[model samples]
Target: MMGLPANRLFCLVLLFLFVPAAVCGASVTRTLSTAEPGAGEVFTVSLSIDGIDLGGVVETLPTGYAFAGTDHPDDRVLVRGQKIGFAVMNDTAITYSVTAPASGSGDITGTWEDFLDETDGEVAVSHVAVDGIETAAESAGEKPAAQEAAPRFAVVAAAAALLLAGRGGRR
Candidate 1:
């Protein structure tokens, strides 16, 4: 650390402190083909699941909606009423379709369980358009945003300044 230049030292510090957390944590996000869909219409939802080795997920659809189909293999998909479960192993993405019935609004909710890692959490919920109306949750359909990184950056900067301040004081 003493021999390294300032920029290089900062880069190395960031790489070491941040990379592990980013790599170990897993998350799921959903995207709707159309934010709004008509009654009796078939709509697609694309799920992006990353950082899993052996695990599964359960997607709970609003009542009156039917699971039309999915691109995932049938053997790995389980359908029980309005809920669908998918057994996943290292899969990064999946797409499924559902048919909206009547006119109503509801949240398309889900959860991710990482069996191998012994971790689980709610999937990022997103409001789907049913009968031309969006789901009620205003924050739906987006990833759980992490806290501001500016604070972390400031800490790193402060540490660097302290390291140089000692040398300047001696000079």
Candidate 2:
């Protein structure tokens, strides 16, 4: 028979054994609705899943921001006396409303943790960042009070340190 030799058959079996280990699931995609917001403003974030269910999901909002609202079924859908509800959208989109406080800049951060059937798989983790909101004071022709006084404070501190050092040297 035109077949693999015994040694080649062993190698083929080993290849099949390692194939599943190398295989991975599709990557999850996470996106934001906007890149920036004004301070103390509310922004909408849309989370989309391409190959997973829309349940058993928990999203963490950026620090100093609060979860304002959600666009999903509120009532718990029941099946056979058990609460069966869609926690996340599968092959669909979900939107969460959040409000950022009046601080921080450069990078705003958040996270999403997704699970399948409530207990069938490990949680999928996704992270997101937005350019943080800028304050009105920053936009106007004025620096933050601390920043404005930084140089003056540094000079005053240096003067005080020098005076203390001179007194100590005399002793």
lDDT of each: 0.74, 0.45
Model 1 residue 137 CA deviation (Å) reads: 12
lDDT of 1 by residue, 54-163 (tens): 89989999778889999999999999999999999889998999998777666688888888766666675666656566544533754345433333444565566556
- Tens digit per residue, CA lDDT, model 2, 14-115: 544543322232223445566566666778766555555544434544445666666766652222211122355564666666665666432323223345
Where does model 1 exceed 4 Å of error?
A: 1-24, 134-171
lDDT for 58 (candidate 1):
93
Cα lDDT for residue 148, model 1? 39
Quote each prediction's TM-score: 0.64, 0.46
